[model samples]
Target: MPIIGMCIDLVAPSLPAIGQSFSVAASVAKSVISLYLLGFAFGNFLSGFLIDSYGRQKIIRLSLLGFIVASLMPIYLHSITWLLFARILQGLTIGAVSVTLRSICADVLPPERLTKLGPWFGTMWGIGPVIGPVIGGYLQVYFGWQAGFYFFAIITLIAFIVVFIVVPETHFNRHPLRIVSIKNNITEILKNHVFIGITALMGLSYALMILFNVSGPFLIQTTLHYSPIFFGHIALYLGVVFVLATFLGRYLLKAHTVEKIWLIAINVSLLVGIIAVIVSYFFKDSVILTTLITALMFISCGVVFPISLGKGLSLFRHIAGTATAVMYLVNISISSIVAYFAGFVDMTSLVPLAWMYLFLVFVIAILYWTVLRKS
Candidate 1:
């Protein structure tokens, strides 16, 4: 999980440096993130068919090998074009590992144990995002942008070794490889309105995090003239809040219910959105205000993340592979689209970021109050 998180997130604080190194606009450099997400989405979408056919462990091994090779491409090839291609390839392979592992857990665990896995999965997942940028930022400051990728390569290589030795194949019931079967499975899952709503809500919640990851570098380092290391620290601080919120969300869910937790998240997001609007309108472009507002917003999003994933995954035990793939595809795809467009927004101002969150949260509120209420 950390490897995958590092693959995607470690480059965040270094976006400005990467742009300067490559001599491109922020929007074009942001493509590194956007393209990776699109690749991840496609990979997850495609893995649904392959994992069901080949079994989980084989696919995971192949994917990790691909990931390691891809991570090295940027260093060896030494060009932005090769770097972008490598990122896309990394995303593709990452999708296989992530989606397959989740499916493996779902396959082996009982309902009671599976219910317990959400927070653990979240914590493991959160650790990467929390530490990856801090490490990457320091790496970029002391070393160079390519140093982060080297770190990625080494860490991922170690992870691949660990998985090779310890992890076992979990998919016992292998479905035959057929295009029609894959399409049918996906279509069947899509018909579940509850699943659709939960997935959409999860996607929107995640987009909030991606919004910052994609835009923070330009906003903080480029516009505010902060150092890359400082930007990394900012990410670390918020990441701590996010991880805490995940654990807190799990505890809260044990005491309350999904609807209640989601309701609270919605209200908090709405409140944060209002404050952001007010700040952006008046303060205009205060880095301190923008960072504070975004940090607070992440708390609400953290609460929403695990609960939605647990609920959505709980709904389709029989088709965990397809379900997990679809869920990630929705999330990464939405995040990629949002992050890509965010580059076009006025990075000199905080208003666009605030407005984007407000609009997304409003949509989530409607979904919850209406279709998602019964579910």
Candidate 2:
């Protein structure tokens, strides 16, 4: 999850240089990031199914190869379209890696362990976006954008090797693979609500950050007139907030239910909306204050993701792959589209982000209170 999130950051710092290299506008060059995410959404669903039918080990090994290969594309090619293609490919691989890993975590650990794992999991994935621009900035300034891709590819290669040697198929099926059986099982997996809700919530939780991906750089660099490095630091702070909040949630779980964690996180969403209004209008667009508030919004992500993910996957042990697919499909699909178009929304004022935040918060809140709480 962390690796997937961080992958795009490798390209962020290089956006300007990449734009110049491709002779495109900064906005146009952003397609590298946008298309990658779209590819990510596309792959999330595919991998969910693949994990179930093919077995995690095979999917894991193959996806890692894809990730490493895609990460290396920029090392040889200078064309913007090719770079975009690499990103798309990497996105698909990342989606598979993320969904599989989360499914593995769900299988291997109990709720206590899940809570313990939450901060670490959130921290790893959160580090991607936060750290990407930071590294990309320095590399773009010192070495070059190409260097970032090279390094990223190399690191993921190591990760792939480690997983290949150490990871095994957690899903112990007595039977061998068969085409008719695979389709029938997948049909059954898609029918479960627990998996559906978990995945839906996954997308919702992630949407907060994805919107940040689309608007964050522009908001900090263009609207607020801060440097990319400054924005990167802000990203770091938000990542830190998420990390710490996840830790806090880990402790909370010792005494509370997953539902309780969701409730608190939902409350945080409301606070973020309220803060967005104040930051947008009152502060007159101060980056420091805005960043701080945004981090709080992101903190809610820590709470819901780890808890809901664990709870949702627990009920679908019989069909882990199909359950996971549902989770990623809903989560990635909704967030990517939302984040992509959200770019067009006016973030010059916090009003747009504020309204969207409030709308989502209330929607989830009402759903939980009237529907889920009863369940």
**Top-scoring candidate (lDDT):** 1
**What is the Cα-based lDDT of residue 145 in candidate 1?**
91
Candidate 1 TM-score, true structure as reference: 0.96
Q: What is the lDDT, from 0 to 100, of the residue 346 in candidate 1? A: 61
Give the per-residue lDDT of model 1 (tens digit) for 1-375.
867666656889778888889898888888888888888887887786788788898889899889889988988897889988998998898988888888888998876667657767777788888998899889989998999888877887898899999999888888888878888888889999998888888878888888888888888888788898998888888888888988988899778878888888897788778778877998766878887888887887788877888878888888788888898899888888887888787677778778887887787788888888876
Cα lDDT of model 2 overall?
0.71
Cα deviation at 141, candidate 2, in Å, is 3.0
Please write out the lDDT profile of model 2 over residues 1-375, one tens digit for every residue.
557767766666565567677797656666676777778876766886677656678888888889888888877876877888998898888888887887677667775565456556766776676667677667776787788888778888888889988998885552245667667766676676555666667677777766666666766776777666676667777767777777776778788888877877887687778767766777756776667666776777777776676666666666666666666666777776776667556567556666677666676677677656766
Query: Positional deviation of 246 in candidate 2, in angstroms?
Result: 1.2
Q: How far is candidate 1 from the true structure (C-alpha RMSD, Å)?
A: 1.4
Off by over 4 Å in 1: none
Residue-pair clash count for candidate 2: 5
